[model samples]
Target: MRIVVLAGGIGGARFLRGLKQAAPDAEITVVGNTGDDIHLFGLKVCPDLDTVMYTLGGGIDEEKGWGRTGETWSVKEELAAYGVGPDWFGLGDRDFATHIVRTQMLAAGYPLSAVTEALCARWRPGVRLIPMSDDRVETHVLIDSPDGSGRKAVHFQEYWVRHRASMPAHAVLPVGADRAAPAPGVLEAIGAADVVLFPPSNPVVSIGTILAVPGIREAIADAAVPVVGLSPVVGGAPVRGMADKVLAAVGVESTAAAVARHYGSGLLDGWLVDTADAASAAEVEEAGIRCRAVPLMMTDTDATARMAQEALDLAEEVRA
Candidate 1:
């Protein structure tokens, strides 16, 4: 089987791990969200792409869910000691090397997709991983300052990593999505896939940002395979991350049914919610999506593989 997965950081990476185990023979292609990419300290950082690569390649810090396991912060600390700080955004010494190499490759006229492939050569992250777009598409959140500093937009990282999404987000926009084209193989993977999946990543910023890239949503909708998704929200809350905040910004409630409706039936053929949210299945199905409720937690690799298997099962059901 050929599977194309639209992914973000941590959650997406973990899901891919289980998908690999669940369907050991399947060919997997990951289209990672680059909207989370940022330029910091004169280096380019592709957080989501790196996360997926590291996690799949056995270089990831399993407990923390991001970054290298045996990481040092000498670079970050040196920068802070010089009072050159955005200390709130943690960048470790080991992780910094990735940004440096990516920035250097980009400066040498390589597109991000090519740079990603080159970097993956070292990590050898089992699947074919590609960026959603070769162009920049940073996600920014519109929020009002709590201390009467008035309304302003901040990078999505600031809203999430810095403030922890505590402030109300009035809007979330992808800064360069207007003219962004799908990275070379993204549309081709979806079109040639037996199944497409939306992992339990942050729906609004992760999956939504990928879809915002021109031609991606259209490609998924027109693909001849089953396109399925697992709910990030389980029992009225996100399994991880502050997805509810961005979902609110987009005017969607953070529930299994609401998330399924947000994606809508046009692009999604199957939707999986946690067993705790089983009551929502009918409402989701009523909205024209085939809904199934199952154990959705990823407490371990076994648990996550079960979730992936369920999604594939749902895809087969949709295909029938």
Candidate 2:
């Protein structure tokens, strides 16, 4: 089986792990969200791509669900001692190596797709991970200016990581997405996929950003295979991250049925809601999407794998 997954950061990475366990023999192609990419201290940082790589590569900090495990803070301490700003975003010593190598390669004129392939060679993430676009398509959030003035745009990282999503967002924009083309092999993977999946990642910023790329959404919508999604909002709230805040910014309610409708029946053929949200399944199905209520928590590998299996089963049903 050939599976194509549009993934964000932690949630997406964790779900990919389960997907791998559920379909060990399947060929998986991940179209990672690059809208979260940011340049920090002269280094390129692809958070979503690196998160998926680290999680699948066995280097992820299991507790935090992001960053390198057993990581030291010497580099972060040194930078702090220098009185450099932006201390809110932590970058450990081990994680700095990745950014430095990536920045170096990018300076050498390699596109993001090539650089990602080069990085994955060492990690061997067991899937073909491609960025949504080689061109920089940063996710920016529009919020009221600091002193309660007019509106201003801030980088998604600054809004989410620094401000902790406390500031009310008026809009979310994937800057440069209008002109960005899908990364090499992204369209091909979707075109050739037997099944396409949208994991329980941040709908507005992560998977939404990937779909913001010019041809990605159209490719998936027009694909011959079934496209399915697992809800990030389990019980009228996000299971992780401040997805509700962004979802609100996008004018979508924070509910399983609402999210399924946000994706729409035209794009998504099947939807999965948590057992806690069993009642929402009917509403989702009523919207022309095949909805199934199942256990959606990623409490452990076994539980997550079960969710993955359920998703694949729904895909088969949709195909039938």
Candidate 3:
């Protein structure tokens, strides 16, 4: 089977690991969200892409579900001692090497897609991971400035990593997605896929931002395969992160049914919600999406794989 997955950060990375276990023989292509990419200290950082790669390659910090395993913080400590910092965003010594190599390759004029491929050669993440767009598409959040000043736009990293999404966001926009084209294999993978899935990643800034790219959303909608999604919101709250804050920014309620509707029946053929949200299944189906209530938590690889299997089963049902 050929499957395409649109993924972002920790939730997405962990889901991909489960998907791999569920379909070991399947050819998986992950279209990673580059909207989370940021340049820090003159080095480019692709957080979502690295998370997926690291998780799949068995290099992920199991406890944190992101970053390198057994990571050290010497470089971060040294930078702090210099008193030059946005110390809130933690990038450890081991993680710095990734940024350094990525920045160096980018400076040599290799597009991000090529650089990612080179890096993955070492990790052998098992799936073909492609950025949503090779062009920069930094997500920014509009929020009130500190000291009760007027509203201002901040990088998504600042709003997410620094403030921890504490402030009310007026809007979330992907700065350069308007002109960005899909990375080399993104469209092709979607076109050739047997199934496509949106994992339980943050809807607004993760999957939503990847869909913001010019052609990706259209490609998935028009593809012959069944496009399914697992709701990130269970009952009335996110499984992880501050997805509710960002979801509110887009005027979507933090509920399984609401999120399924947010994606819409036109794009999504099937939707999965947690058993905790079984009551919302009918509402999702009424909106023209095939809905099922299943266990959606990623408590462990085994549990997560069951969720993946449920998603694939729903896709096949839709296809039938």
Candidate 4:
């Protein structure tokens, strides 16, 4: 099968691993979200891309879910001693090597898509991972502080890592999205896909960011295959990450049915909700998309693979 998956960071990476286990022979192409990319210490840091690559490439810190395995904090400590901060986002020494290479390639006039391919050359992440867009598209969060002043826009990472999503967000903006074109292979992958799966990733920032790129959503809508989505909301809350906070920013409800409707039947052909939300299946189906209730928890590889199978099964059902 030619499967195209829209991915975010840690959760997307884990789901991809399970998808591989579920269908080892299938061809998978991942369109990774690049809205979290930031320039730090003169190096280009693509957090979401690196997270997926390292997690699948077997160099990831499984416990932390981000950064490299067997990581050391000497570089972080030294930087801190020099009063060079933004210490909230931990960039390990080993992970720094990746940013260095990526930055060098980008500076040498290689597009981000090409630089990502060059980086993946060493990691061999198994699937072809492409950025959502070659053009810069950064996700920013608009939030009001404790003083109740006007809303101010902050980088997604700053809202996520530094503030921990504690503040109420007024809006979520994908800066530069209006002009950002999908990366070279992104639309083609979706256009030629046998199945398009939306992993149980943060809908607003992860999958939503990918869709923000021009032509990506249109490609999926125009694809001849089924487009299926797994709810990140298992039981009224996200499996991981503060997805609810961001979802609220866009006036979307946090329920499984509401999230499915947020993506809408126009874009999605099938929706997978947790067994706990079986009651909501009918509502989703009523929205013009086929819905299935299954165990959507990623407890381990086996459980995640089961979820992947369920999604594929639903895709087949919708196609039939």
Give the Å shift of residue 89 in candidate 1: 1.2
- For candidate 3, the C-alpha RMSD (Å) to the true structure equals 0.7
Task: Give the alpha carbon lDDT tens digit for every residue of 1-320 in model 2.
Answer: 99999999999999999999999999999999999999888899999999999999999999999899999999888888998867988788889999999999999999999999999999999999999999999999999998878999999999999999997889999999999999999999999999999999998999999999989999999998999999999889999999999999989999999999999999999999999999988899999999999999999888999999999999999999
What TM-score would each prediction reach against the true structure? 0.99, 0.99, 0.99, 0.98
Runs in model 3 deviating more than 4 A are none
Better of 1 and 4 by lDDT: 1
**Pairs with steric clashes in candidate 3:** none
Each model's lDDT: 0.95, 0.95, 0.94, 0.93
lDDT by residue (73-110, candidate 1, tens digit) is 99988998999968888889999999999999999999
Return whichever of 3 and 4 wins on lDDT. 3
* Model 4 Cα lDDT, one tens digit per residue, 39-154: 88888899999999998899999998999998888988999999998899899999999998989989999999999999999999999999999899889999986676877899
Q: Is candidate 2 or candidate 4 better by TM-score?
A: 2
Q: What value does the lDDT take at residue 215 in candidate 1? A: 98
Query: How does candidate 1 score on lDDT?
Result: 0.95
Give per-residue CA lDDT, model 3, range 88-206, as digits (tens): 87787778898999999999999999999999998999999999999999999999989788999999999999999999999998999999999999999999999999999998999
